[model samples]
Target: MQQAAPSASLPERARGVIPGGVNSGQRNVPGLTDLVITRAQGASFWDSDGRRYTDYHAAFGPPLLGHNDPDVVRAVAEAGGSLDLCGVGVTEGEVELAETLVELVPSMERVLLTSTGSEATFHALRVARAATGRRLVVKFQGCYHGWHDSVSLNVISAPDRVGHKDPISTGILPEVLDATLVLPFNDRDAVRAAFAEHGADIAAVILEPVPHNVGCLLPDQEFLVTLREECTRHGSVLVFDEVITGVRHGLGGWQEVAGIVPDLTTMGKAIANGYPIGAIGGRADLMDMFSSRPGAPVFFAGTYNGHPAVVAAALATLRKLHAEPVHEHVFRLGERVRTELPPVLASLGVPAVVTGYGSVFVTYFMDRLPHTYDDLLDNDTRMFVGYRRRMIDQGVFELPLNLKRSHFSYAHTDADVDRLIEVTEAAVRAQLADEGPLTDMDGTSTMGGATRC
Candidate 1:
């Protein structure tokens, strides 16, 4: 191993070993990653430079109760004293967490825990394939399930590749790409056509019910119902990839809110409130493939699938959620942002649409809001990135990337939201003054020949 220079900056040192000086591609924000975070508590994080910023990124939506939440911290600490990985058998914490998930998530009758959302989705697809004895999977273009090769393609693809197979990374086999069918979100006819053409081959239809990865493209209820009906008719498993939407939206997830149930649901991000935990849950018959029986086909094995401290943290987070009005507070603040931010931008001649549900938001530089990824093609990518970058400069931490949604935590208050709005106005004003001519005839500066970065 090599060592960084004693005086070298954190990012400078990190780029030497870590790819792009970040672990995840989403964390590779141009300006935001330059500084290393020192610590975070409540609704803000402090950088190594000793500057505090009100956080809207929320560690990509994991810190729903906010960074280093006291309740979660105490629970983890307590668990650490008495409980560690035993590996041979299950712990009480894991069982309780699973029980809590089954009780809360409307669709989950049985549950399996994994260490990350990627693993949960991987297990989910595997379970679906094993259950249906099918190879092909159907995913919406903008909804990102995870990094596994099966569903890696077609998220935030370039304009030319909008409706085609465009893998985010190399090394994914062409056959793997071919096995997954990607379609436009909120397009009921497209979904129906795909089902009509190849429903029998599709093992599962997986999507983020709200499609938060490409900024919230709210699902049409009819489109969801269509998927449910089609998958039922075809014997294909219907999966809701709720990794981003899981406990953040509600205890029952978006499925409960939408009154639409899926055969399988993958959860993470906010489930444990910043702990390293992920879960896959669904129908008992389907999940039984991983049962510890003499002839169970699916292989379900993990050394640290449900680490005690992590499960304890999750249980504590849920307790706080049940005891406090977390959803009510965050939802009200989120609604305030959605209602207040747009008109403020419009007044500044910055034609933008703020889109999200509950505690997430994204300011799209477009006239009308989007219903599908195709509708987002015309969004001003340059301006979208620029505005977020500007917000970061002004001490409001919006991820400086196009199409990424901002997350509000339970720690955020009315004052924090007020600061966000004030900084947002300043950010837009600064961008318009610097860039010049930010609007087009249709009220959005089009991306126009530029690729999504």
Candidate 2:
């Protein structure tokens, strides 16, 4: 195959070959469709046009230690030099990594490794079905488990599609959609109703615990407790999809903070600090369903399940996290952003709410904070995306999309947070100056187009 000519722009040439000129659909920013990153290091990435951006997107919350950290790079290099894939046997790095996970995460008596968060969730669901001998899986409306058929539906749904089975993609079997029950997050009555009607057939109740995908909807303690209690009473496995909240929130994951232990926990993202690694850990009895021997109840196999270099990266990241004041620093910076941003927004006459846990923040363009996916319908998507787009134009790299979380890494400094606030103020000023202040004339945002939900 012939490659495109050197004279062509990167995005243009990429479009000739790759779908949407990007590998992932999420990478294709809404208005800024051709944004191309060249290289990244500690808290910032350079664009193809030689523009530097202080990164808060953090590659969708995977680069917890920041991009291309020296420790992770060095560990990966050393492991690559000495170890290569030996598919039949586990490497020492893999065992040590698994041991660290089991030791750190709250719900792990046994662990299975995969290469992506989606794969981890996939295997977790399989294990749940095997353990319970049931077909129904319960998930929250805004909580995204993965791209798999079982749990892909009902995230970021349109207003018209809310409270319905709205699959994020096509080609999912109707039966798969029917088997998965989607309920509103933090709604105890809906949860009780689901279990009350179909408790006997419920295989699992899975959630993000925080639902960071919708820009960090904090879980109500009562809601989480209800989920735990219902899952226990119904003999259904409780699966916490902590792929975004795992090591990023703390070494023990969100379950540790929430004081609720799920039967199975799927993790990734911050685990390897940007490396391609994912894992599912749970009660030994349920996890033991997978075996390499014949007639295993659940078949779990991946060629690169425990790649030596990735394992080395994970170990090094975890070690650095423990050795350094990582959580303290990032959490402080996150708090600073959350605290400082509201004043800036208010000064600029932008009605917004800032909310997140440690090392994460999100700006929701609404008067009040949201507790459920239905409440998010009030979010002015126009102002949300407009403000972020303006920030990106000023070289602050927040993903210019609605309902996306902004992340902070260990490499970020107080200076970065200040810069973010400075850029945000300027962005909101420029937006308001260009377009008049918000009005309820048509019951929608007049900044851009109609409010999209």
Could you say which candidate leads in lDDT? 2
Q: Compose the digit string of candidate 2's lDDT tens values, residues 140-255.
A: 88888878998988888778888889988889999999999999999999999999999999999899999988898999999999999999998999999999999999999999
- Tens digits of per-residue lDDT for model 1, 120-198: 8898899899988899999988878888998888887778988789898899999999999988888889888998999
* Cα lDDT computed for each candidate against the true fold: 0.86, 0.87
The alpha-carbon deviation from the true structure for residue 235 of candidate 2, after best TM-score superposition, in angstroms, is 0.2
Model 1 vs truth, CA RMSD: 3.1
- In angstroms, the error of model 1 at 315 is 0.5
As for model 2, its CA RMSD to the true structure in angstroms is 2.9
User: How far in Å is the alpha carbon of 14 misplaced in model 1?
Assistant: 1.9
Off by over 4 Å in 1: 291-294, 436-453
Against the true structure, what is each candidate's TM-score? 0.95, 0.95
